[model samples]
Target: MIHDQTLDQATESSKAKKAVLYRMVMDKHTCPWGLKSKYLLERLGYEVEDHWLTTREQVDAFKARHGVTTTPQTFIGGKRIGGHSDLRTHFGLRLQDPKATSYRPVLAVFATGAGLALAASWAAFDTPFTLRAAEWFVSMTMMLLAMLKLQDVEQFSTMFLGYDLLAKRFVPYAYAYPVLEWTAGALMTAHALPWLSIPIGLAIGGIGGLSVFYAVYIQKRELKCACVGGSGAVPLGFVSLTENLFMVAMALWMLARMI
Candidate 1:
């Protein structure tokens, strides 16, 4: 049933390639779905606005504006696109959008190297209470990086297509990093095992550096960036050199401290 008022507004609204304002409740699945739609819309040459309507007043205003009472509602070109099912209907089958970037280990490596360096510097050189604070910084950085990678709606479909294949196909085996870094940085400061800390930090840096380098090689040879989070700006050969060198530097510092 078409509401006269809704139709009138749809027609009357400025014909400037209308924006889609989506209203959804704050929930685990709904939020991700909503974000995915927003990203898809952006890629499809549309501007989409997402609002979490948790209050009655907000919902009322939204209904008045868009003329839809049911939710996971999407307003595109002043027309309503329903829930997840509706969104799927819109996309049909080209879910992956082949041009979309895949997750790359190089990006993760770069982010990790920067994070570890910051954590180590703060933990090693800062005041007495700074060790624990540095640990928090490193853990939070690693966790946040992982979260951002997970939230990349652009890669949503590709990730699903070859979960098994891609899961093991990471350029530099990047998944082992967070634990290595968090543990290395924590042990270096907490237990003050200078000898152990050198090796641990070096290992963390070494793995990251090698991964980024290989990613660069793959990128140049294949003309594809496998690093995640749209961070292909970092070239791998340089990234690898920088990372390995950084690890070696950290090892030297740790060794000096032990001596």
Candidate 2:
């Protein structure tokens, strides 16, 4: 009797591995996310029943019938498992908080800028790199960050006021901050006008470091960092502080070399 019961339970478990995925795959454009969902399901050992909607009308009809706004909808044991991200959550794979702030945008900008600097260094000076390469990397990163802020200066300024002591006191400083950073970065990269670039870097970096420390550590405020842009999803923490410290270090280094 016990052996028969175990066999029945195993059979039920095997049956539960069956899944259905309804997705859009039209001629003009097949949904990339839909393909991702199908791949995820198959990789997880599910026997997927793939239903492809080949026309826009068919896609619309399917969505309407299912009362869902988006496709690649999944069903497991006759239960809706939602989209790709949702499916990952169901499998305990995705642990990200949807509302939590991230430093990805800033990190990406720094990474790409650093790569560009290294490439420039290799092309100009050849092998073994140098301290100058590090300087170039920092300068280029600053320029990129400034450009991101310049995309929507008004929005950036609004977010900037949250933690920047100068911005909070003098609204115009917030508006002018991106331009100052850009000018400093451009001059530093070109190794031109050290007088202007060094001062700007030191002033901004010093003020920024102090403000970030006070807001993030002293006050312990959980606010968004405006480092990358005005989106305000980047958390105010180590990454933000590090950017300022890098600026300060670079400025000091340049000053010492000049002296």
Candidate 3:
């Protein structure tokens, strides 16, 4: 992502050229998802200009000014590309096809384990026999989540790969969903609140929905994602919706089963 000042300079310089300007309102650390998105786009050969906006007020202002809501909000050719998740599907769908092997399973397993761990911790420590074991569990879960993400070789590849617009856009959104799973799981574990994970899962599912929504728009226009790093045939739009819907169902089931 280009610095705000640098973006301004480039925009001014490109006044005579047909250059597309993009912006992302995100925090650097907590929203590591945004960073991954930026990485994907850059990897896919797109020039992206990013800006940070932390508060809901800031997000609102961007939406009011640009007429949209969602984080990692993006604008291209002076048009809204929607938010981070939207862009992720946009780029992924543009790719060729899914490889025979995928890291998605690893991610799913990690998430399930984290969730079950939290449930176990809650059941065990619910009584007064434990000494702040909940806190310890929470911390450990958080660490595990971070470690799980870091363990993915694909993430490291996505991070260090050359900059592509599709890649830059997709990486953040793709990486974010999994991270959210872990974070929500960790938070639920920490509080020993299994019910909360349902909402959190639903929220993550919503992100997938957003991506699918945008993908349909892209497909209707017949534009392919340029962001796929080496992965081919990115599934756009409604595919994301299907995935999200499945996630929502799974989360609901998990909640019911656990309770």
Best by TM-score: 2
Candidate 3 C-alpha error for residue 155, in Å: 7.1
**TM-score of model number 2:** 0.83
Superposition-based RMSD of candidate 2 using all C-alpha atoms, in angstroms: 6.3
**Which runs of model 1 end up more than 4 angstroms from their true locations?**
1-178, 218-245
Query: Model 3 misses residue 203 by how many Å?
Result: 0.5
lDDT of 3 by residue, 1-259 (tens): 3345544544454353221333444454345556665665554456776676666676678678776654556565676666556665554433323454344543454455456556665777775334344333433433453454445636533532232233345666545544555666565445456567668667666654554455455435332221222232333334334445655665565576676
| Clash pairs, model 2 backbone | none
Question: Lowest lDDT 10-mer window, candidate 3?
Answer: 223-232
lDDT of each: 0.50, 0.85, 0.50
Error of 2 at 85 (Å): 3.4
Tens-place lDDT digits, model 2, residues 107-213 = 79989888988898888889427777888999999999999999999999998998999989999999999899999999999999999999999999889899999
Which of candidates 2 and 3 is the stronger one according to lDDT?
Answer: 2
The residue-level lDDT of candidate 2 at 51 comes to 91
